[model samples]
Target: MTSTTLRGVTIDYDDLGPPAGLPVLLVHGHPFDRTLWAPQARALTGAGHRVVTPDLRGYGRSGVTPGKVLLADFADDLAALLDHLGIERAVVGGVSMGGQIAMEFQLRHPRRVRALVLSDTSAAAETDEGKRFRNRLADRLLAEGMDGYAYEVVDKMLADYNVTAMPDVAARVLEMMCATDPRGAAAALRGRAERPDYREVLAAVEAPVLIAVGADDAYTPVAEAEAIHRLVPHATLAVIEKAGHLPGAEQPERFNAALLEFLAAQV
Candidate 1:
């Protein structure tokens, strides 16, 4: 793990694999940390790709900001990280909120993107109801802390089978959520509520794209992935069976296989 100051915050990230290998930056979703991509990091590193996974501003060991944090803020932090590492370009990817951040990054720094990997994310703007809900959740988190919210959404975060059968994965997910700072998480929620629509952003992408999702994801289902695929006609879509929101963790082998194949053929 390495720490660097970017945009007035300390960002914590892991730099794995050989220095000369192709760089792959993987971003974790809301309420989760870089550990969410541990399996993928190992697999990609073994396949001779450099994998950089960062605990976005408030999630893991990184510094936290108490108020709202725009997706642009997160995107800029990633750009700064690449600059810090002297990386001119990379295959940038993310899951859920991270995926949105990846899109924002591509929008802001198109030349720095080699390819895209968007997993279980949407390209649409936040609905009015969603904004209200997110604001309410943010208030709840700031008032109550993470325990209740963590336990409440843990099951929803992964497939029911994962919660029941994959105890270790379930525990890790829960632990990451429970340990997150409420102030940071709340700030993120508020920021995410104001996110811009990215449908046009998706249509403008020129890089090779890989869109993967869990077949059973309730939050961002297969249809959402299909929508993204349609926007980027050249994208390769991979739907992992028996997984939910976090397929990369619920079904790491399958997720890693899809990712490795995409990197080999596309980027």
Candidate 2:
């Protein structure tokens, strides 16, 4: 892990892939660290693309003591990570809540994003039920503490295959979940769950966009991916069968293939 100070905040990240290849920035979802991207990063780098994954502000090794940073602030941290790495423009992708931050980053600074990918993420247009879930989740986190909250989230994150066929990966994910700061996780959830709808920006993003979802992702189902695909003029939607919300971890091979195909087309 490498550390850099940006905007008076300490940012921690990992840089991989070939030095000469185009950069691919991987942003993780709630309660996860850069390690969540290891499989995807390896596959991308093996295919000749540079990969960079960062721990979000207040998550993993990154300092969260500064307190209550917004999703836009997370995006700013991404910007700082890229700048520190001397990457001018790169492909950026994220899963779930991480996808929301990626969208905000592109909207705030389009020139910095060469390509975009969203996996199992809502359009930032929450339904009454979705809002309720967010609120209830926040309340639960405060009540049960981070460890208890993490177990619930980890259950939703992975599918049967992850538990059965990929027990090691599942264990790793649980460890990361347990490591998360409950207060920080709760704060991040509250901050981003209330973000404005990005449907308009979806239609406006000119770069090649990939909207992916696992076939069995109950959290953000394939229908949501379809909606995002329809909104983006140049977006392609891919479904990884028999996987759940965290397909990049649950079904890395399938997810990596789809991502590579989309990125290759862009190049």
lDDT of each: 0.95, 0.85
Which sections of candidate 2 miss by over 4 Å?
65-67, 127-136, 139-143
Candidate 1 segments whose C-alpha is farther than 4 A from its true place: none
**Tens digits of lDDT, candidate 1, 51-147:** 9999999899999999999999999999999999999999999999999999999999999999999999999999999999999999999999999
Clashes of each: 0, 0
Error of 1 at 31 (Å): 0.3
Model 2 poorest 10 in a row by lDDT: 62-71
Judging by TM-score against the true structure, name the best candidate. Answer: 1
* TM-score for candidate 1, residues paired by index: 0.99
In angstroms, the error of model 2 at 65 is: 4.4
Cand. 1 Cα-lDDT: 0.95
TM-score of each: 0.99, 0.93
Residues 6-61, model 2: lDDT tens digits: 87767788898787897999999988899999999899999899999988877898
| Model 2 accuracy (lDDT, Cα) | 0.85
Q: Which residue pairs in model 1 clash with each other? A: none
Question: Model 2 TM-score?
Answer: 0.93
